[model samples]
Target: MSRLAYGGDYNPEQWPEEVWHEDVALMREAGVTMVSVGVFSWARLETAPGVHDFGWLDRLLDLLHAGGIRVALATPTVAPPAWFYAAHPEALPVTKEGVRYGFGSRGAICHSSAAYRQAAAGITEQLARRYGKHPAVALWHVHNEYGVPVNACYCEASGEEFRSWLRARYQTLDALNTAWGTAFWGQHYGDWAHIDAPRVTPTVGNPAQQLDYARFTDETLRGNFIAERDILHRLAPGVPVTTNFMTALSQCDSMDYWAWGREVDLVAQDHYLITDGRRTHVNLAMAADLTRSVAGGAPWLVLEHSTSGVNWQPRNPAKRPGEMARNSLGHVARGSEGAMFFQWRQSRQGAEKFHSAMLPHAGTANRVWREVVALGADIGALAGIAGSRTMADAAMVWDWQSWWAQNLEWRPTEDHDARERADSFYETLYDRHLTVDFAHPEADLSAYPLVVVPALYLATEAVGQNLRAYVEGGGTLVVSYFSGIVDEHDTVHPGAYPGALRDVLGLTVEEWSPLLRGERVRIEAADGSVLPADVWTEFVVPNVPRGAEPVWTYADGRAAAGPAITRHQLGRGAAWYISTRLAPEALDTVLAAAAADAGISPRDDLPRDVEVVRRTGEHGSYLFAINHTATEAKVPLGAAGTELLTGERAAGVLAVPPGAVRVVRAD
Candidate 1:
């Protein structure tokens, strides 16, 4: 069985029957082996209520099977038939502003709506029963990207559901009140009726209330996913089910993917390049790494990414020649089992008419189409790379709940974005050619010698306890400022600013000074080199436990006399605290010190534009060397082996052209 599942979302129902023949021929020519169908075809599948017209889908599947392609049949639950909302208006999702969204857009139904759940489950059951034993069906794509448009439903039903969820989480109203700190400002709730899902409030609503709302919404969506997934599992026993995740680019508070990842059979991602005209290969790599981690260090899938440009962004810039190939191969280099796209053919009419596809508007003559064919063939040749996992020596901590809590109201500064902070640290490690795996805050930290946790603003006692044990167990922990300051409910921990971490760091932060826009403070390292600091700074008073020491301090600021960076040794390992946001150069300096302490030597001698990552399997190890820059460069192969892409004999030095990828099994 070839594990490289190439091809993409194929919507043959969108075109006439004659076009389907041409699509099949092109699919084979492009070396496509799989096609995802019926993702947004609820109207075609179910015309009115339960009256399903799977006639079109059945023909589509039969034709695809005849063409020797597998199907990842999707339940048309993303966009319900227009008649569904008309028959049941309660299915509509209300936004935080209390406005009910219309049915024209996808994901407009509330996850908390029982009617929507029943309808979704009914359709999924129908699909599974019909295609469960079909020869063409290989996988089940449960629903399209969940929570893309409206993640939260601030309606009366959601409020009732929120109360129910609270009851389940904290049995009694007294327990709920205590957990939410409702006693503040005479807001103590005597009954569960007082609770709502944090709608349009006059001022910053209770932080605990808002936090619970986020949790409730995520669980609600997960419940909906499980409902559909269960139907598929029961009807289609052996078929693996998955849902596409928006990954690092997702803005929805609902759907904690770490929790959702555990439920899915395979972790899949839908990543589109940043359309702001910025280079995004590194961002793509990071998302793939996180998805791989969520999959328990196994190979996953790239369910959907634009073949060229996407329509949603403010300006949809087309990918340059070979850029798409580079992007897809990058994901595969990390741990993607396959490389797929948003669609097989371009849409003639729809909101996403401008979104690029495998067969573009220019037809077979276009450069995008040519590149797509080439990429498909290239991906097919690397079938042996399947089942191989990218081995990483370092891990980065990721918490979706903390992402929501860190961006709430009434913070010391309004500029604390946890994702940006984490990405910065990940980029530093990538530049050093160190592979990084994203681990949950509570995950086993013993696998990696170094762990970098950034801006974990909302931390629990258990999280702190876990990191303390990890460091004491001989692992290096690098935690940033504004971390471990708040408990799970968004309540500030008493005593020191960095609450539980103060003990592990052997320091206590007395006060915090948030920097204004354009304001900068200089931090001096032991080497007398100064680095600019911004956004935030904590005035630290280190207790300096017997094994702890100071690393850096503010050269001049309101907290100029305080320590800026402190390190403490616990058992055999050590923990370092960065008290402020250091400039890029300064951050490198700080991370360099930690890297050195962890005995991780930076692999910096390679060409600056080339990226090297290794994946090991039972067959041995394969090295993926990618040239991200535009110019050609000669890279030293270090060992001689056969290049998997071109089947060329690669010796001591390999000539890598711009936007090229070489997968070699070296000696």
Candidate 2:
């Protein structure tokens, strides 16, 4: 029988030996088939210098196996014992402010430090050699989240290393100088020694230098991850290796997970609910979609989330009665195979004592534990979703490089946030109840019927070529303004506003008009109705290519009579460009038209608060309808099928209660 790995971070080492037995009993009661152990146990596993102790871990693993629980054994390299850091102080990470991180907390080691790397390799080798073939070991959990606290290291050692990395990338100082455009401020570098990691500069440092530093920081973390991964691959052959990632790309900007995703066996992420009294569940759906995309749309895992409220956020609100189950299964609806909380048992001491766990501070007699058990049963019943993948009809372009470069010192407007812009388009699609995936800028665009590129401020020639090919080959493309305007080096293209895509878009922007934060502008739609716009407005003289026309023009402003939105027809497909930020309602109107052109229909039968996602299984497609509101919602399944949870034949209308979910097998 298939089962979802149901338990979470288990720190038995922190408790007494007598408590392990009770924890096992509770684990069985909660239907936890697996638990991740030894994540923060590095200090305990290694008492002193090179001396190691595995007796405690050996007993714990054996006990878990006997309890019919599998193990996602973790390499405790995330937090090295204080002894190692004391022995090799040079391995400590330096902050942007130039202070070496103390050893009290986790994630204090420098990824670029050779001493840290050597010590990591030693511990990893020991763990793999000892537990690689253990019967209880099911998966290899690599070091915890890589760029949590110490993503960028700015010490002299990192400075030297960054110079070396640049030398290898550009191959010559002259090339590096040219790529950075060092002649602008008479700040040309004559040799490799002059370049640093962009640490504590008098003014805003060079955009190119900051961009490269972000890349280097990403690579360094990946290097540390790969060092441990290689050891496990050799010793624990066939056992999958993975590391948990934080919520979104913007949260950990330094790590390029698109690159890191290729290294892990399967993608896993930690996402906490945002209960700010808004449409917060949309954020959950977005995060899950991104994780599935990172896993190539395959089933992945939720390595860590809270059972109730997390202690970290400023005002962590406890989830309502049924909200937890809805949140967990929501991820499953988006191709997550498992949903595990941050911990198995609540901590009585330490930093995260209040972070919710399977068993809260109050034992299994409480509502949280009952909900945990019910959710476990629900997940186990739907094990048929294990190998399923969520198929999306549309994709939105997302890139960390573009996000990093878009935030450079000099820009048209400070309101241009790459993630927010991309999400604005995504929010419009979501309002239309259309499923979407997050696609890399240069990824294969053939699979998607419609591709939306929002605020792609720092586009590369290769990305532009890919997009052009996609449009010319019968694919619909929608690009926002400020895109295709610059090369990868943050250098603006010579001609047209969107230089690489000007010909395809069939418009030449003569000048850009940026608005202040609260300023508002209006655009005249094709219907002669005025619509609201903000942040940016471009004045374009339409050279109007053979098959292109201006769809929306500025009504009456400084940039009046210019194109605000345009549509073009290539060989067999079409492209649309929005030249300014629009209100959500106006943006939805624009996207609704583009979606129609692509033959994509919104699920109008379902309420907007009820999210409907489809995943294909061997039996058939499973339709999950999740209601995120506080009231009951009636949804039309559009097919005759059995609701998997209650085993009732749900034909047309399905009633989903507030904060609940319904999974139906489509007939």
Model 2 segments more than 4 A misplaced: 247-250, 545-547
**Candidate 2: residue 432 lDDT (0-100):** 85
Over 1-667, each residue of candidate 2 has an lDDT whose tens digit, in order, gives 1587788999998789999999999999888988999999888888886799999999999999899999999999889888887788878888887888777888887888888888889988999999999888889999998888778889988999999999999999889988999998887998788888788877878888888898888998898899899999999998899999874643566677788888999899988876666566777888888888888887889888888899887899888898889889988898888888899999999999989999988998999999999988888888777788897879998887888898878787788777778667877888888788988888998988899998787777788788888888888899998888888888888876788778677777888889887888899977888899988898876673374578889986678888888888887788898988887899998998898888887667877778888999686889999998888989887788989888889987999888889999988
Q: List lDDT for all candidates, in order.
A: 0.85, 0.85
* lDDT (10s digit) by residue, model 1, range 329-362: 9898889998988899999998988889999988
| TM-scores vs. true structure, each candidate | 0.98, 0.97
Worst 10-residue lDDT window, candidate 2:
246-255
| Candidate 1 structure, TM-score to reference | 0.98
